[model samples]
Target: MRKTTYLLPALVVAIVVVLSSIFVVDEREKALVLQFGQIKAVKEEPGLAFKIPLIQEVVRYDDRILSLDTQTIEVTPSDDRRLVVDAFARYRIADVVQFRQAVGVGGIRVAEDRLSGILNAQIREVLGADQVTSDRILSKDRGELMIRIRDSARVQARSLGLDVVDVRLKQTNLPQRNLEATFDRMKAEREREAADEIARGNEAAQRVRALADRTVVETLSVADRDANVIRGEADAERNRIFADAYGADPEFFAFYRSLQAYETSLKGDNSTMVMTPDSQFFEYFKNELSTNGSVTLPDPVARAEAPDAPAPDAPEAPEMPEPFNLTPVDPAPVDPAPESPEAVDPTPEAVDPAPAPEAPEADTPPADN
Candidate 1:
């Protein structure tokens, strides 16, 4: 009975000790054997691991890839342009022994904090290079720039036993104040360009208008010159026609001119003229009277010169003969002379005159004369 009790308690104690010494390491995790706060063994592969009971303990960590999201940080580029950058990293605990030594009990949390700082530093360094600009950071080359950032971060992360797989810029943006200022600058530039375009258009329009005006003036000048030439030719032709008509008949032309003068002189019914009867204007009337055998009146000058001539009652004067036409006519006998001149009355009523002759027979001789 005593042997059974001792052997049973010994077996129970052995089982407890064995159970405490063994620990499980999953495929997704790595295990660290710690002896009184000191690292004794590292179990990287999956399955069961052993440790000294009551004197040692096992610490497990994730072996799979991890992600870390960094806080938004402000960085300035080579051009002195400030930007807000947000980034993320893909990493893993590459050296678990080194990770335990460096991080101690803080585990993945401490590792993440240190790696995040490293990534932020490298981001600022690569993005702030002299050749890098804000435009390039936001351009298609961003991927290549991120690769550089990752490589730089990896170099610094080696001390922390972290394997930096990749680093990527998640978001990039300008500050709110800078964005507003840029918008204002762009708007002003566009307005200036628009004004310049309008001015150029007006200048071209004015040039075209001036050219059109010049063309119109030139065309009008040419037309007026041609019209004047045509008018001069017409006037010359009219004068030539008048000259030819006058050369054809000089007498007819004179007669026509006289008639035109008469028309001009006697234009109205109230017109009056005071001219002598013996004037050349009566030449046509005298010729008609002579042709019809009518006696012509003596000129006023001849009557005035014959004041001492014989009177009509005196018989001493020879009888006058009739004027000839185609042949001569005989003279009539004269009475005995009364030498002294007969007493004559100077007044118009004293003499008994012969009967007035008709207009057609005024030139014929009287039988009693």
Candidate 2:
């Protein structure tokens, strides 16, 4: 009974010791065996690992890729333009032992902090180069700049047992103090371009308008000249026709002109005219009587020199000849009379014994059609 009690207790103590010495490492993690704060073994593979109980302890670290977000930082480029930048990084523990030694009890937390500082420093150095500008930082070429930051940060991260896989700028922006000013400048530039375009457009339009006006003036001038030429030709043709008609029959032309005049003057029922009966305008009417009989003409100069009113009640002049008949009549043969002395001289022999002048004849009315 005594042996059983002693063996059972010893077995229990050994089992406890064995169980405490065994440690497990997952596929996603790496294990570190440390003896009094000094690394003794590294378990990089997933499996059961042994350690001295109460003397050696195992620390597990994630072997997967990690992410780190850096704080926003302000950097000034070579042109003295200030910018705010945010960045992020992808990294992994390349040397777990070195990581443990470097971070000590703080582990991944402390390592990340140190890595962030290194990344920030590298970012500032590369971006603040003499040839670097804010435009380059914000452009597609920014990818190259990020590569440079990663390469640079990778070198510095080695000391903390970190491998920087990639570095990227998350945001690049103008500082708040300069944002409004930058926007104002851009707006002004656009407005100036717009004004220039408008001015050019107006100038082109004015040129087109002027060209159109000049063309219109030229066209009108040509049209007017053609119209004047046509009118001149027409007038010449009309004059030629008039000349031909006049040359063919001057008397008939005169008659036609008189008829046209009569038509024009008597176009309306209310037409009125005042003229002496012996005026040339009535030559046709007077000549109608001459067609049947010869007309007698008096010498104006002799009549004016000799004609004077006879004394009243002097010897009655011989009975005056009767007036000619107005209607047409057949000719009748008659005896020839002796020539009168007054017929040649167109004056009486004695003006003082001349008879009173016969009453004037009444005016004849125009013939009806």
Model 1, stretches more than 4 Å misplaced?
187-369
Error of 1 at 117 (Å): 1.4
Per-residue CA lDDT of model 1 for 1-369, tens digit only, reads 999989999999999999999989999988889888888899999998899999999998888999999989989999998999999999998988888889888999999999989999999999998889999999998999999999999988888888999998999998988989878988999999999999999999999999999999999999999999997787667556545644553334334444344444444435556555444543322332345677464332332334344423312323434431222122233332221123222221232333444678466676794
Q: What shift in Å separates residue 187 of candidate 1 from its native position after superposition?
A: 4.1
Highest lDDT against the true fold, candidate: 2
In the range 1-369, model 2's lDDT, one tens digit per residue, is: 999999999999999999999989999989999999888999998889899999999888999999999999999999899999999999999899989889999988899899999999999999999899998888798999999999999998998888999998999999999999999999999999999999999999999999999999999999999999997887677677766755554444455555444544454435455555445664444322244576533332333344463322322234434442223222243332223222221112211232446999999998998
- For candidate 2, the per-residue lDDT at 328 reads 23
Every model's Cα RMSD, please?
Answer: 23.6, 18.1
Q: Which clashing pairs does model 1 show? A: none
lDDT of 2 at 138: 82
